[model samples]
Target: MSRSIEYGNLMHDAMRGLIRKVLQDVADHGLPGAHHFFITFDTGHPDAELADWLSDRYPDEMTVVVQHWYDNLEVTDDGFSITLNFGDAPEPLYIPYDAIKTFVDPSVEFGLRFETQDSDAEDDEAEDPAAPAHLPAVKPKGKKLKPDETKSTSDKEDEAGVKDAEIVSLDSFRK
Candidate 1:
């Protein structure tokens, strides 16, 4: 007897659909009751762009929080666009759908993961296991710190050092 598992692409498409639905919900009802998103994606992905200045500053990844004080939130077929305050400057960003690496809502424990499609296979034949695991890429100048950095000392103390809830992986959904 022989047995085999089929690694169909259904799971990948479904995960993408799920994320789209989540975003649609937010767009329709305006982030119902404490539900905000932490979206991380590859800034260099084919269809994404930050301000020229932002891209130069954060070449690898960038993450953004969709919560209070955001404006012009629009979703497009290719991706989405919104204006966010960077310190005193309100900058607009356009991120493509394919570039998204991770999408998580800490309030509900829901998350999605995506594969990074390589544009040039010959340039690199393998991935680096020793490098830090990829979370969503985040901008260095943003309000939130990189996932590795902790919040301010006073904020840490106020929360009694309780760890924040996060979705660590989407591998379980894959077949």
Candidate 2:
């Protein structure tokens, strides 16, 4: 056992693809029936793109509901964009896959918790178990983040000079 094959990273990449497919499908069509999503991301994470007000409102983490009142939902190769209502106003949002921390469709109880860590972590590794589980994304209009999906959250963080992202490992419970 090498204890360093990075299997977790592989799993994270696959999960990101799955999230992309779902978001793309929804962007093209629409939410099927009762299938809404609970997206949680690190608002403080450097890679996120959301509005200033939103960031102020949710500093560390925030979750938004994607059900009936959203518009301009576009999913692209690297990320996605959409406008959501806030206090009777529609605001734009953009989120890269790397920023996502958690994704869940409670209608099916299907959810994913990603790995999050500080700037010192190496090779896009797992999150610190002691840190908060999930949070919100930045700047406004597009695909925002949620749990780990081993999606990378760099470039944006690089621009911001801060560190943030997510993924969850059950390793802590076994020992």
Candidate 3:
């Protein structure tokens, strides 16, 4: 029996850790400069908590912007909870890190997307630990990102030979 490294899952965990670290910094010092986020998550995830109306509207997935106005930002090992204004009606939400499908900081044209696995396939993998996991073709949804429209002071610094913004997909790492 040959054992193979699950690079996909490993990368996913590392990315999630990165998200956790970034959110922790924002919670401690507030969003620096023009830094902001557009986090999209699976509202249907078992651990995700949000208003019934919000779930109804978004159904499978939802994106929330963390900028300008927000409150009660509490980050834990498992997830974070926040209160956001909805038409002057503030709503509290708890989003587990595992439920997050996408996290984007348009201010920098940076984004991370997580491909969801089918429950049946996961079960099969659980039963046969050696089975190779398949990477699904995940199409990212939400507002289209225009790097030009979002060019910031940092982006302008790219003229000095800094790298341009890029959206990273884990699938690209798959073998």
Candidate 4:
């Protein structure tokens, strides 16, 4: 079998690393200026943990805003845990990096989208009992965010002048 480079996975890893680094900085030092994050994730991910109500409300996916108020931000190699307020009710969540679908910081008009597939450990075990199961393989997709995907703006001028986020893809540099 010929070995080939997995550019998709590589790009995804790099993006996730960037998220990790950003979160780590925030965890160490508070969010700077008007900087905040809008993180959307797959609530159904095996490693994802959240309140039952949140799961029931957003069975498939959920978006949490990390601005104005948030707490208990703990970042790990595999995932991060945070507490966010929902209608005055505090909810704690643990989201794995593989579970993240989109991460946007509208303060800087930056964003990232990841397409991922969970690996079946059972299938891997069947093929090689001694082999360790692999984590999800993530594919990166750089796209402009839809209007609804962003935080709502009350200013009509702001809405009308909304800027499309720049797509950052590695494909251009690959060749």
Candidate 5:
């Protein structure tokens, strides 16, 4: 037989269950002495439930420390939720299993690192529902800059790598 079955998906799913189980135990019983978790996840992931301000601050990825003060730690099959201190107040965070890239318990020297997954988020989906995504103010679309407003210096050209680029005309390829 030449056909081969891929077990990588199965292994990944099984491993995720292990993380769920460990978190469930932590929810049931208070964290044992010196035992805590350091979870790292993609902050920009669409399913990640966190403050938009936080996601903006940590655009790509973020690591959260769940130690002595976390409350309402709940783990479901799809994701987990917990209240953590942010600034001077408590904020809830929800992280889907798929978003997690690293889990560690330094107290026990246990660590698991997962390969990063391709982001599924589209432009609109990146907006957090609970809080609007923090973004720089932008002018409305379709506005044309006046010739005087256009950049005259080559500074931007060098930064954009356009200075070394050869101009290509699509008309040449057509004929």
Candidate 6:
């Protein structure tokens, strides 16, 4: 007997759920100890809307930092809302999970990326359709930077020593 491949929309839903949880946690506990988020989203996504000016400004992609000076955060079944200070003006934004492209927390080096999907197809299949129109795209795994690309603190110290030796040579010339 052979088993059929189980490809469904469960993963997509699960990812949405996780994004919801992360937002919920932040809203509840107020970003808990040095954890800020960089959220990138598609501005044209159905569930995403910005002020007319903002939409015009960032027609494609926008990234927002949720760290300090945010207010009026509310989470709902459909989406979440928050007020951000944009250049001395407070703007309210409501973002749906489907619109999110990426969420990164550099403090813990944890990040999540959501696959883009057709909004209409997703809604239709979500309404009791058998299979999702498209499978969730596999997330690309990131490899650590090579040693040559990444310099450790010791390498900085060595460079500092070389600079100090140059300074000593200059002092001897002055003497």
Winning model by lDDT: 3
RMSD of each: 10.0, 11.6, 11.8, 11.1, 17.8, 15.8
Residue-level lDDT of model 1, residues 1-175, one tens digit each, is: 8965433235555665666776666777788887777677777887786787556545666667777767777786668888876554678988777777667676665666665446465245443322323443332322455556422101121143432222233233223
- Cα lDDT of model 2 overall? 0.64
lDDT of 5 at 113: 59
How many clashes would you count in candidate 2?
Answer: 47
Q: After superposition, how far is residue 6 of candidate 3 from its true place, in Å?
A: 0.8
lDDT of 2 by residue, 1-175 (tens): 4666655567667777888999999998899999987677677777677889678756776666687789999998777788877655677888777677777776665767677434475654455432333432232322454543323222133244443332223222222
Could you tell which candidate, 1 or 4, scores higher by TM-score? 4
Q: After superposing candidate 5, which stretches have Cα over 4 Å from the reference?
A: 1-3, 117-175
Which of candidates 1 and 5 reaches a greater TM-score?
5
lDDT of 5 by residue, 1-175 (tens): 7976544445567667888999999999988898887677878778888876566545676667787689989999998999886544577999998787666676765666564334574354343222311221222223432332211111123343432111211122221
Q: TM-score, each model?
A: 0.62, 0.65, 0.67, 0.67, 0.63, 0.62
By lDDT, rank the candidates, best first.
3, 4, 2, 5, 6, 1
Clashing pairs in 6: none
- Please give, for residues 59-154, the per-residue lDDT of candidate 4 as tens digits: 777667787888999999898999987655677999999898777776765777785535553243242221222212222344433444322111
**After aligning candidate 1 to the native by TM-score, how far in Å is the CA of 27 from where it should be?**
2.1
Clashing residue pair totals per candidate (backbone < 3 A): 4, 47, 0, 0, 0, 0
lDDT of 6 at 67: 76
| lDDT at 131, model 2 | 38
CA-lDDT, candidates in order: 0.59, 0.64, 0.68, 0.67, 0.61, 0.59
* Tens digit of per-residue lDDT, candidate 6, span 1-175: 9985534356666766877888888888888888887676778888886787666656666667777778888887777888986656678998887787666665665666665456466564343322222212222223222322211111112332421001111112121
Across 1-175, the per-residue lDDT of candidate 3 in tens digits comes to: 9998886678778888989999999989999999888787888999999988667646677667788899999999899999986655678999999998777776665677777556466654442222233322333323234433221111111343532222333344444
- Distance from true position, residue 98, model 5, in Å? 0.9
